[model samples]
Target chain A: MNVLPRRQFIGQCCAAVGATGMMSALSALRATAAAASIPSGNNLPGTEADVASDYRALVCIFLNGGNDASNLIVPYDASGYAAYASARTALALPQSTLLPILPKTSDGRSFALHPSTGELKNLFEGGKLAILANVGTLVEPTTVAQYKAQSVKLPPQLFSHNDQQAQWQSSIPDQPFKTGWGGRMADLVNSLNTNSAVSMSMTLNGVNSFQVGNLISQLSVQPASASSPKGGPVAFARTTGGNNPNRYQTQKDLFTSPQSNLFSSAFGTLSSNAIGNSDALAAALAATGTIATSFPDTSLGNQLKSIAYLISAAGTLKLKRQVFFARIGGWDTHADQVEADVSLGAHAGLLQQVSQAMNAFYNATIELGCANQVTTFTASDFGRTFTSNGDGSDHGWGGHHLVLGGAVKGGDIYGRMPSPVVNGPDDTGLGRWIPTTSVDEYGATLARWFGVSDTNLPVAFPNIGRFAKPNLGFLG
Target chain B: MKPATIYLAVAAGFLLLLLVLRPDAGVATDPRSPRIAAPPAPPASAAPALAASPVASEERSPLADGLNAPAGTVDEDLRIVATLIEVFRSNFPRDGNPTGSNAEITAALTGRNRLRLALVPPDHPALNARGELCDRWGTPFFFHSESRVQTEIRSAGPDRKHWTEDDVVTKQ
Candidate 1:
């Protein structure tokens, strides 16, 4: 009997208002609207209270500082290994140390995971994780010859850190950064929720470029800490007290006040909504039972635990759809790529953290019984140079990424794998590769599975039309 | 002479003739050989002259651009320009930030011969019309001297536009 102590129980009560409170608020509001629209005399079909029956979530795990993915997914076959080693020089992983995985496509070409990727290997072998090869920001479908010739327009800011990361989320590198695909998707489908005031997109990280939309800004929350406003109605949003009810009511009035200025009015409305959402979500999470799966104490692990709590509360909150964002930084390994033994270093540590955290998150989804309804994917700024600059590699384009869920077609690699040919057909010169698969194709596939219609797919991904295949077919 | 002795002598003479002639060597005069000559080696000409350098030119000259290209290519002409830029940046003040003018910085180098040899290479393009260091697309590299310990170096990228998507700047 593992009994939660009194202080620990109080701490859990304080932490009950998890990340996706805004989604729940919106759902509640939408359900209210549906109920209101029904006529008193004539009994029309009222708002379906069970909209939560078809709950789904999309989680985007962004690896900051441009994760060097050339080493993440490696070639295991003899000929492939030789080419990779020759090109990478000192930075290549030893063939003997790699963890080989049986890919579905057995064309005499096999691949192995990074030595630190044992957890991810288990997920792959268990048919729950799929690898998307050589994917990156692209304006249109580009060929090697066209890229070299500059015949087709290329993605903007090919290697700049901020710009490339922005493009990975925004999908329009040439233009300015204002909105991201996640926010756009939320804008397109958020109306389906009965609640209109709360946004469907939520972030554990503070503010980000990924969830910025024209109309719907994502709700922000800290995974381990409360919102902790300096002095607002939401500061004690989830707290129940009657000592100074006037101060709380005064703050609430300030939040709901309609200022003459447009911006002030909007801010007031948003503040009021935040307070309302905090109170409701706190009650719902308090009533929800604990999850059986335990996550690590790492930052990403804590973020995933918070997301699991939010997913479990989906039924209570009446949320039909949701998108959550979580991230971890410091993957930029320009120095000290590995120790002399070639076993552990900064990059390997990041890989191990990602593997363990993702594995645990998947287990949590299964525990919640929504494993098939939710999907998780990885995104990065860009791949790193295959060539080593003595100690480490430089920033590059076109990287391999991971897609994991129960609905994913696992044990396979989607898209064309770029040949590890430095200065050969695939390389530009210093081991930077042009992506064979575009971001449009990747995002469209995920959006399609998220219940987006073909016609409205462009709302989420504007340039989806340029690519021939919007869906990459990884989803079931 | 006996018939056997005559036949052995004839065979020996034929072997010696074959060795001396060497018909398979593929000399043009040997009618039995193929007509074409061997493939040419990659040209490694000396750097172009100083006066003809792009820095001295009235108009910006366009060179090839492959600064960020991957390896395994035979026709990448712009790598030399990128390599030279890397070397030039390495020659900055010890603290990695330079406040002095280009001439002052060039003179302060401890190793003068290394800079002199690289500053002017024959047949090596990448000199803009202003005779300054630029990328293959004629985009000039700007050296902003704001900080005392560090100077900003950036190249106007492929579109010949400044501060756009294709700009390549030094890591701060």
Candidate 2:
């Protein structure tokens, strides 16, 4: 036989193997195509070498039920407080009880946080937290005039809960929902991970629309429990325990066996991959050591703690990029949202839980040496009305959210803060302020920081070009 | 002829002329006129005669005149009924589900339901003895709703019948 060059021989063997494993080979080829598509002099912040070696994560803490953000972040100045107090009426917090925070940049007005969010106040002062103001779902840049005249397109079902939730997650309000921004971002950067045992996208809570992607599937993992501090992968019932080796083997055979039916074959293949991936992730978590940071014991606290643990196991799993989702509910406070003591009530209690849990999670990241590598952000269905409907506020658009991580340019507020006046210039009516910032701009900022190039930003947020700011600059 | 005799003849001729042309002037029986009859006056017994307190009068004044008099164009009558329903909704925001039947909404407005504050006085002329809200024509108003929050109110107009072309409607 004619002797071929060693490199040529190896290349021929790979091409021959690629023909047999077309699906797996196609993923590798797509990754190569994605890298090749990046034009020279790209807007990505780091060099290609840094992009290949570094790891980053995004944690989305969805505050289920529309959060009454008017109470969460309040005005502290004399005139500003007067306006807020006049609009909110009975729902307003006492001026003296607020936890004061002075942002690095000011719009000639002062502000403060709720009394319950003392931990968050510390994070803000320490330059680890930034506030994003007046952000919400928008079909396009809309003005109060445009809204009243019905000249500009608006997101469908403005105040209803489920529609707004999906709009916030998908970030493509103009189109029918197919994938979430987080899901699309993961699909774009999935090539960064050379040896990920589990999917790059993970949710501590159950499956969510935020992590639904076409190429990559989100792995739903349990929160950290007292028994298992680092939460383990969701396993098959048979694999959990019992001296039934025959049952486990039989289940395995059912998944591995060939099926002539198309549906059955697809099911078998999906089930087999799930089982195999779960086993691999479990093994990886078991081998990795735990971190020393302490976490709170609440539900949200447990979820964040589990995320911190997963971040710790990133090395063992060989993941370069990760995205996480967690959620907390009971924010729909239409009635009895506050007691006679405005500073203390259902809303304040929820804020306290969020502040404490986030503080603990941030400390955990610091201990794991990935404080700058991990960014956690908050989202909600919409903001509550500035004007109270008797005891509580109603659903409104454009709320404030919090962003926290070492990489954040913290101790500052980003986005235009709406004037807290009912039927003011920004108000569409009844204190529902038209959003100054779109969700597309907000998600694109985080996506850019997470290694997505400027050219591919629209793949994640299709409407980012419609908004003035693609990157909100909250992240460094 | 003499002057007195001539004057008397002219007056007689003018009188005859007036009599002959009066039938052609179309005063009461003009076919081209719209001919909207005035709403029937409510019965005297239907009006409430109570010592009015300041609070009760303030709450009752807006609907009191419209309910007691009940004489207006169809659009005006529809406006009164729509305003009544709007006031009811504002006071009891939790009670979003207003029934489509005229008697049911009339009962709720008259303080017969929970939170009995009597948004509309029971003795108001707009309500019949059966406690159903009535149009200017003394016919019960028809209510239709597709959503709990929005209700359409229809007045029977001068014909005093439902589902006719002469009905006036408004939504609240």
Candidate 3:
């Protein structure tokens, strides 16, 4: 019984035309090409589309602004915690507020999450959360002295935003490139799609480096409250006045009339497209009902709601394989640690939202009878320093991340956590700890689980061979 | 005027406007060409010793061709160099366009450190020598500069101001 907002309804009309029209255009182009060529019968294979309607997917939640991983995964063991406590003088999380995690082997080695991650604890206990420790970008295995002396060939711009972002997404830090690991995966497997309405890749966040590819563009989804464009064709299509044999009359009138040049005839077409897509997606979403699973009420929570709604309408979309991108930021605490956490109230709340929403989403899949088919993971630019800069923390490397899904060998920590020692041999003079694990290893593992062949892995992540293990041993 | 005449006049006017805007569309194609011609020579105030700053000796300077580089090739090089410079601003969030994929690059090229290259002439030794430097960086160092000038990488030297005359690893 709830009606969409007036502004939203209009925006939906615009978005519909934009996305659906483009998709239809691309599909038509593809169809023409397909008809011209003989069927290999081996069309684009390996997408969620190729498999059973009940399949799993991987959702990557990237926390921008270099989340302070030092605080997220604290050293819980006696000697390790002491080393952490001493090095992180002002930046240490209190022992009381910590959520203790006891690893399988209690060789007295453990860690704790910040008090803000209560939902994360529940998920971890429920065997849904798996921690990935101390991962970062690396051209090759590098040492601190080598880093300072510049002896090793490293990622082009270390500690750089644009380059690192591209590097993280492309897995090629050295040059301008095409497509991300996920996009490449979709390229390999999108043949299984039933219809062309939904893209294999979906980004709740706007267009990002990770979701862009030479041939693939991420289907951008705005939050529920945000307006989506409308779809379909000309307004007043049913009614026609006078002799309509010639279209010149309307064209003449439009051209002669003075209007906002910025928002002109061309914009009208663009708006129409946007609205078209919004209407299609919205209409598709309405068939979805109160999901049994509950999502958090935060921004990410709302995003998850939309994701769930879309997933509920997956049959309508005719999608087989789907990849989604979403995240929560504000972890850049450089001023007040306590106040930063407070200010990052939305962010902390977002994490809970992610955990709850993901759980709900997973349940919805199970309800749809597709539990083992969906996977979710988290990533960031880099980890924050263990030591706080008085009020907050500074950017550092080798932070912890998490991956969750039914397919993941959940309830365990992967990768080695460095000893939190300031200016130690492992430390790069600053709090930046050398990463034992590379993003290549992490991405390769996910790609492999997503059905990427070992041969295609290097093509997806060129630098994956430089690492000791192509597989991170986390996914089955 | 008759309606047909009005329509004809409007259509003609619109066609003229389209033709006028045609050049404007091309303007978006290459933005660095103007900066390269004048070489906004970073105001003398910032790097006071820039004039006295050591220029590589003829033997050490690969780009002794003067100021000019090949035509469209120079512009291409400028685009790549501009991308590289913008990469530096990525780490400094305070001075960065911490948003999406392309916006960050645009923001980095806006202020004082915005990219520029000066083309001297085809025969300039600096321009000719720059060919070697361009090959080394995997692209031309500066657009329009006969002597290809460029910011040094770690191999050239850590100082961001310096440029290398030779690719040392290939020297042997």
Candidate 3 displacement at residue A304 in angstroms: 1.4
Candidates, ranked, lDDT:
2, 1, 3
Which residue segments of model 1 deviate by more than 4 Å? A1-53, A225-250, A253-269, B1-56, B59-172
- What value of lDDT does candidate 1 attain over all alpha carbons? 0.62
Worst 10 residues of 3 chain A by lDDT: A230-239
Q: How does the DockQ of candidate 3 come out?
A: 0.02
Return the TM-score for candidate 1, rounded to 2 decimals: 0.67
lDDT of each residue in A303-342, candidate 1, tens digit only? 7777777677555555678888899997766667776565
Q: Which lDDT tens digits does candidate 2 get at residues A50-95?
A: 3223889999999998899988899899998999999988888899
Using Cα atoms, each model's DockQ against the true complex is 0.02, 0.02, 0.02
Better of 2 and 3 by DockQ: 3
- Show model 2 residue runs off by greater than 4 Å: A1-53, A239-243, A260-262, B1-172
Q: Judge candidate 3 against the unseen true structure and give its global Cα lDDT, from 0 to 1.
A: 0.54
lDDT of 3 by residue, B1-172 (tens): 8995585456435533443364333221233434222233443223211121212211111112222244434333333333333232332322332121121222222221222211111233322232223322333232111001122222222221112343221100
Clashes of 3: 80
Better of 1 and 3 by TM-score: 1
lDDT of 3 by residue, A1-476 (tens): 12344344333222222333455334322321221122223333222333365444678787776777787778877777888878777666567667898654443568887777776777677776788888888778777776654456666444444456566777775555455777677666566665655466666765566755444456556655434221111122211343343553454354345567655754444433433444454455554444566555666666665665566555555566777777666665554445434325433444555556667666655665555677788888777666654455655667788887667777778887776678777676447777888888998898887767898888778888889989988787
lDDT of 3 at A181: 71
* TM-score values for chain B across all models: 0.35, 0.60, 0.18
